[model samples]
Target chain A: MPKHTIISVSDLNGALKDVVEDTFSDLWVEGEVSNFKAHTSGHLYFSLKDHQSQISCALWQFNRKYLFFTPRDGMKVLAHGALSLYPPRGTYSFVVKSMRPAGEGDLNLAFEALKQKLAAEGLFSTHKKQKLPRYPQRIGVITSETGAAIQDILRVIQYRFPMVHVLLIPVMVQGPGAAEEIARAIYQFNAQSDPIDVLLIGRGGGSIEDLWAFNEEVVARAIYHSTIPIISAVGHETDVTIADFVADVRAATPSNAAELATPDQREVLQIIANLRYTIKNRTLRKLEVEQERLRNLRGSYALNRPRMMLEEQLRRLIEIKRQLLRTTQLQVQQARTSLQLREGQLQQLDPNAPLKRGYVQVFRDQTLLLRANETHPQQLLTLRFLDGSVAVVVNEVSQDR
Target chain B: MSQRLSEHTFSEAIQSLEQIVRTLEQPVPLEEALSLYEEGLSLAHFCEARLQEAQLRIEKLSLQPSEVHPSTL
Candidate 1:
């Protein structure tokens, strides 16, 4: 094509703006951010630069709301949008729809990569998590010595369980070599002959860069390999680190880690006091039951009416004795009457009664006067009369009718 | 009763005390109940003493000459 003669400057600039906008539109450019400015109208103007090249970029508030993080000068970013040009200024610029920190994006990518690798290795599995000691006698803390994290942890532990022994293994929680230091602290705790019951490793809240040590693969591996139960309290409540996934327990803050380490002594005391009260009450109830049994026995008739029971037995014995005595007296009286009747009958049959009627009994050895025919002369006889005895001679024999 | 209460820790003492309390709740003979009550009282005393006398002791591990890693400082 032949070049046109006498073209206006405005026309040239307008043509260039259309060509630049149509060609470089909807492309991603990578560079370090410079002269970053945010106007009060919620619009951003910045320059994307490299070692040998530079371009201007603008972001509207509508698009800025989609950014995950705020952009700053000297930060490497990947800006996505169209190349825009202004006719009046005769300048070409990139209209940014979105921007990201290249370094942070890489860190985030690495974070995701490591998380997937560890998760596949079963480091974040629930079964791999060691059960935290319900009552930890000794607590091993791995954190910065002079940080507010240590102060917060110590305060919570002292308030909750004063009896716990806190062993602070001061370690660099951030910056270079922090991951190695944290990992070594864990190993050191495990190497001891008498390891602590639980380990609390954490630092206060900060940016992802500041808290990057916790997300390191070395720190995650160390936490996974810990023989003692580990509680990870790495950042604020909203922040989650890789260490949290590998630890046995994940606490939202440093103070929360201390709370999870040991049980509250005050709560324990209250439980013990309740137990004591229950025991005393149970014992008293036992005594009451026993007393009730004793009272029943005491009020029984056998114990209270000993005399009455004996009196009843005594009355029965007396009645039996009286009946025996009456029977014996009747037998004696009947025997006496029979003896007297027999005596009367015997007395009437006596031969002395005939003698009392004046009859006489004669003996015949010397002659008897009862018969005359049987007597011989010159015989003497003796006779028995009622009142006297007489002697007689029989001269004649006579028969009396 | 074989384990001396004084030798037990606060947790152990509390556990034994709770056991005694549970036994007492059952229908036991008077003599046995009396003995259990005595044991519970002793263990309760031990737990209270432990809770009252316990103090917080914080021990800082000495930094090695070559491995002095002060993070925030």
Candidate 2:
């Protein structure tokens, strides 16, 4: 060892800072955060600790802008940066460049925690899910512009329902501000005066880190509160995000999302075709039934042989006429019999008939006496026979009782 | 009649045509049946025309980056 030489504290700190920077730079440290403080100037100051020891960390505004989440006290994080030192105080700290929740398990744990929280809030409830339109005329898409997700969606939509209007709201699917972008896009769509029927929000296959934006609370809440039905297709069939749980529908792929948004045009066309055929067939069948009824009416006796119907009526009329004549003849015979009987009665009462039966009538002058009480005592009388009449004078003055 | 058909969507036109067909199947007067037949035929034609004329339209909603910044979060 060399002989001791006295030196200033700054000199010692500078030497220490250089050694720490060279050795600890570009290393990762995982620990739970405590005493976290965000300065007014946008700098974050915190401590990374374990059960045994702890270290100070400072994240400047420049690096802090890239953080996907706000670090809180007791949050376990994996920090990337180098060791830094303050020479004046002879203190050392970590100058963090980037930070993430430590480990996939931690992320999963965070996901589970958020899911449970939102579930308690009724965000993932089935009753909250809106039913999609049967035929969505206008479809809104939320995804990256240059990704294969959009291409697949476009292809599937074109092939299935060609008439739909697709409005793509391109967004950053992954990055610091991606979740906000997606949520804002959804709000923008809702804000429009003319609303889209449904929204397809998704991306192609990717790792969890690549799909972290979709798992964000902002995105999940946006999907949960959306008035428009959302079909979440975050990744391949295996990848599940919070968005999927909160969305109205979960599609295995972006193409399937598009398919779910609209009815198949070909199938609708087939239905129309079948309806057309049915209408034609029904109309024809109706016409056939009517025509058959008309034919039966034309084949009836009254229509086919009108002359025969009239001849039958004429025969009935002739029969009625003959019956009337017979009735008249019977009436005339009865009248003749009655007249003969009356004539016989008059003949029986006739004095002329009695005279012809040898009975005589006496009359005085022009008057004839019918009873003794009606005769005069002294009067010229006439004796009339059936053939002659004679006058008798007062010789027969004595009245015969 | 064409303007009316233009106002109808594919589903609406099909539904109307179906209604007309169902009514025609009942005991309708000849004049009403003939008119319903004519209407159904035109609706069918209109639906077919719409299906043939329709084309998929894709549009991009141009959003400014500053308008949707994560600072709002």
Best by TM-score: 2
Assess candidate 2 and give its lDDT. Answer: 0.83
Q: What is the C-alpha lDDT of each candidate?
A: 0.82, 0.83
- Cα lDDT tens digits for candidate 1, A37-72: 999999999899999999988998887643545677
lDDT of 2 at A194: 68
TM-score of each: 0.55, 0.59
lDDT of 1 by residue, B25-49 (tens): 7899999999999999888888788
TM-score of chain A of 1: 0.51
DockQ of candidate 1 is: 0.33
Off by over 4 Å in 2: A1-32, A35-102, A286-401, B1-8, B21-30, B64-73
Best by DockQ: 2
Model 2: per-residue Cα lDDT over A312-380, one tens digit each: 889999999999999999999999999999999988988799899887788865677776555545667
